[model samples]
Target chain A: MRITELFDNGEFVVTAEVGPPKGISADHVVEEAKTYLSGITAVNVTDNQSSVMRMGSLPACVALKNAGLTPILQLTCRDRNRIALQSELLGAAMLGIDNILCLTGDHTKMGDHPGAKPVFDLDSVSLLHTACQLEKGVDLAGNPLVGEAPKFAKGAVVSPCSDSVDAQLAKMERKVMAGAEYFQTQAVFDSEKFIQFMEKAKQFGKPVQLGVIIPKSAGMAKFMNKNVAGVHVPQWMIDELAADKEKAKAGITGVELAAKVIKECRPYCQGLHIMALGWEAKVPELLKQAGI
Target chain B: MLITELKNKDTILSLVSGKVFIINCHGCKDIHFPEQEAEALQKELAAGGNVTGIFTTDYICNPENLKLRLGYHAEAIAQADMILVFSCGVGVQTVAAAYEDKKVCAACDTYALPGYQGVTPLEHDCKQCGECFLNLTGGICPLTACSKSLVNGQCGGAKDGKCEVDPDMECGWERIMRRLAQVGRLDALKCPVQVRNYATDDEVKSK
Candidate 1:
C-alpha cells in the first residue's frame, strides 16, 4: 500500500526501529522484536545506523516482514555511492518493502576500530534526489534504467530541536522537494519547543512523526540528553525516573513519562516513531497507557 | 597525488618540513608511500595553495608496531590542517586515531577482504564481522554479496545469469547458488533467516 494511504487512514501509526544482530540467528534479537511487533504499525530495520558495520539491514527487514509485520527499511548513504544506493532501492522495491528512511551515516572514525574507512561519496540530500530519480526510472546521471524502476514511499529525518533549527528546516524543505513523502524527527522532549518548530514545519504541508525514545533508565535519559545529538531529556523527567530506586518502578515511571509526551504531541504529529533502544517489550504498555 | 614507496633515512629526512614530516614506526628509518604523499603535499603547499599535512606510516602487525606507527603519524596529524590516508588495513585505523582531531579522508574505497592475506589488505571484498550466513542461501551473501541484499529475489534485469547492474559479474545469489551446488549443499536454502547485528558498542568509538 502507498504511504499516502497509510497516512490518510490515520491508524494511530506506531513505528519501531529494530537493530539487527551481528551473529547468525540469535534467538534473543528475534524474541526482542516479537515482543513489540503487535503494538506498532511498522518496524524499521536500520542499515548500520551508526556506521558500525553489522548484519545487513535488508535481511532484518525481511525477517520482520516474514513475521507478519510491515517493515520500513532504513537505508544510508555513508557506505554506498549513487549506484549502490539506487541498486539497493530497486532491490527493496522487488522485495515488497514499501517504506524507506534515508540518512547520511556517521563517519567511520566514530566506529570501533577507527582504522575502518568511510564512503561518503553522496550525502543525505543527494541521496534524497537520487531516490527521486529512481522513482522516476532514471539514474542520478540522468540515464534511464533498462527496466522499470520500483516505487518506494520515501521518508527523511530532521532534528526539530537542532541548535540551528532554520538550517534543519532548509534541509527538510530540500528533502520534501526531492520526493520525500514523510519525515521523522529526532528524539524530542520539550513539547513547547517542538510546537514552535512545528509552526515552521507546518508550512511544508507534509506529514511529520515525532521521535519518542523510551529511556531505559534515569541515567540513560541523562546520557542521551548530553551525548546524543538533537536529543533533549528534561531534568524533571530524569529526576522522576531517579526517584524510583527499584528497577521495575523506574521502568514504570519512564513509561508514564513517555505516555504523557505521546498524549501531548498526538494532536500535532501525524504519528509517533518510538525508539525503545533495547527496551522493545515495554513499548506496548506505554502505547496502551497513552490511549494511542 | 604521485604516491611512491619510501626506501631509506636520507629520503625520509629529505621529505620533512613544517608542512611535511616523517610518519613512520619506531626502531626503523625508512621511506614509504605515506612519506612520498607527504613530500608531494609539501610541494603542493609551497606552490601557494591552502594545502594540508600528509601521512607517512605503515600498516601495523602488532600492538608495539601500532604504538610506534601512532606516535609517528600523531606528530604530522597534530601540526597539519588535514590528514589523508593512501594505504589500507591497520594503517587506516592508526592514521585515523592519530589524526582524530583533524579532517580525515581516505584515498581508496574500503571493502571487506578475505583473510588469507596476513593482516588482510585494506581493500576488502566484504566487511566480515563473523556473521557468515553465506554458508546458507547458496553461498551468495544476501547481506553483502548481493548488490541489493534482496533475499529470494532476482531482478528481471538479470540477463543470462549476469546482473543487470554490471554484465561482467554474476548475480550475487546466483554465484552463491552455483558454489553451493558444486559442494552439494544447495539444501542450505531452507527457511528464511534474519540478518545478524554485527555492530557493537566497541565498533562505535567516536560519534
Candidate 2:
C-alpha cells in the first residue's frame, strides 16, 4: 500500500531503519531487514547515515521492496545539488519507492572521512519546497510541466531534545511550512522533554515519529549521549544498562528501555522508529514489549 | 545633437556648497531614449528628485565618441555626490576610469554583445562552460537540458518525447539522440560521461 494511504488509515504504526551495507552488495543487510518487515509498517533505508560513504540507499530500498516491505528512502542534501536531488527523487518514484525523509545530512567534517566535499546547493527547507513543487507538477522556477510530476509523501527530521527547544520548534515550523507531511525527531530518550516538544509541535498539525535508538551496550549509550547532537540519554538508563555485563543481557536491556519510552509517548506520537543499527533482530521483541 | 538638462547640478553644488561650473561633453543626445522612459525620468527630475544628466550616445554603439563625451561630462561628475550612466557601450568604461572614487551606477543590466555589431540583448541562459557533454547524450544538455539533469539516464518521468516535469520540451536525452542522429554524429556519442561543473563561483567571477 502507498505510505500516504497507510498513514491516513490511522492506526498506531511502527517503523524501523536498516542501514545499507558499506559495500555495493545488499545480501548482508537484506537478511537483517526481513526479520522486522512483518512487524513494522515500513522500513527506512539510510543514505550514507554517517559521513562515511557506503552502498547507495536506492538499491537497498529496492532490496527491501523485493522482500515485500515498504521502503522510506532517506535523502540527504549534503551529497547532491538541486539538479541531482530532483533527478533522484523522480528515479525513486519511478522505481516504486514513494516515501522520502529529507535531511540536511551530517557535515562532511563529522563523517569518518573528513576530507569529502559537500554539496549543499539547497538546504533542507528548499529541498522540501522543491518536493512540494514536484508533487504539484511544477518545476523549481514555478513553470508548469506539460504533464504531471510524481507525487511523493515528504517527511523531514527534527530534534526535539536540542539544546534550545525554541530554536528546534522554529526549524520545525519552517519544515512544516515547506511541505513536510510528517516529522521523525532525533533520538529521544527523555519522555518529559519530548512531551514538552510535542506541545509546541502540535501547532503545526503534523504527525511526529519519536526516534528510539537501541544501544548495543552501556558504553554505546554513553557515547551517543556525549557525542550525538540532540540525543539526551539520562544517567539512570545508562546505569541500568551498565548493570548487565553480558552482551546479550545488555541488548535486551536496550530494547526494554526503548519499549518503555515508546509505551510512555505512544499517546503523543503517531509511531516509534526503532534504530537498531546492527541489532536489527531485537526490534520484534521491542515492538512486542511495547504491545504495538 | 540632443540637449538634456543637468538637473542635480545646483543641488549637488549646494550639498558640496561651492561655486561648481560643470560641463558635459557626452552631451545628452546619443543615449538611447525610449520616449516614455525619458518622459518618466524628466517628470521625476522636474518634481525636484535626483536626476543625473543624460548622455549623447548609446554607449555600446559609439565607442570612439565615449572618451570625448566623458571628457565633457567630467566636471558635473566630479562636483556631484554620484555619477549615474544612462548610456550603453564604451561610455561606461570611460566614465568609470575617470571618476575612480565617484559613486557610479548603471541603469542597464550588463551583457557583452558579439563584438561591436550593435547590442543584441542576450537572455541569461545556463552558463556554457567549454566542457560540452551535450554531444554525448544528444543535443539536449544533460546539465541544463534535462528538467532534473540526471547524469546516468533519464528519470522515471521521461514519458513519450516530453519531460515528466515539463511535457513541452523533449527530454534532454531524447533531444540529444535526435540531434546526434540528424548530424550523423551518433557514432561519436560513445565517450565516458564526465560530470558537468555548475559551480556558481566560476560564472560569477567571469561576470
* CA lDDT, every model vs. true structure: 0.61, 0.63
- In terms of TM-score, how similar is model 2 to the real structure? 0.60
Q: Write the per-residue lDDT of candidate 1 for residues B1-207, one digit (tens) a residue.
A: 112222233432332333433233221222124445445644654475333333344444244555665664565455664443344323433443443343333332222333333443332232333233432443234555554444332222233455544557666655555554554444444433232333333245112
- Regions of candidate 1 where Cα sits further than 4 Å from its true position: A247-250, B1-207
lDDT of 1 by residue, A1-292 (tens): 5555688777556788888887677356566777766657888788876666788888777777777778888887667766798888888888888788887665555566456656555556567678878878898767898777877778888888765565466557756766778888887887877889998998988889888887667888878765566677888888878877585354788788888888888888898888888778788888889887
What TM value does model 1 have? 0.58
Looking at model 1, residue B206 earns an lDDT score of: 15
Writing each residue's lDDT as its tens digit, candidate 2 over B18-51 gives 2222222333343333345444553554355344
Candidate 2 ranges beyond 4 A from true positions: A143-146, A247-250, B1-207
Among all candidates shown, the one with the greatest lDDT: 2
For candidate 2, lDDT tens digit of each residue in A161-262? 866454356556667777888888888899999988898899988888889887677788888765666777899998888886684364778878888898
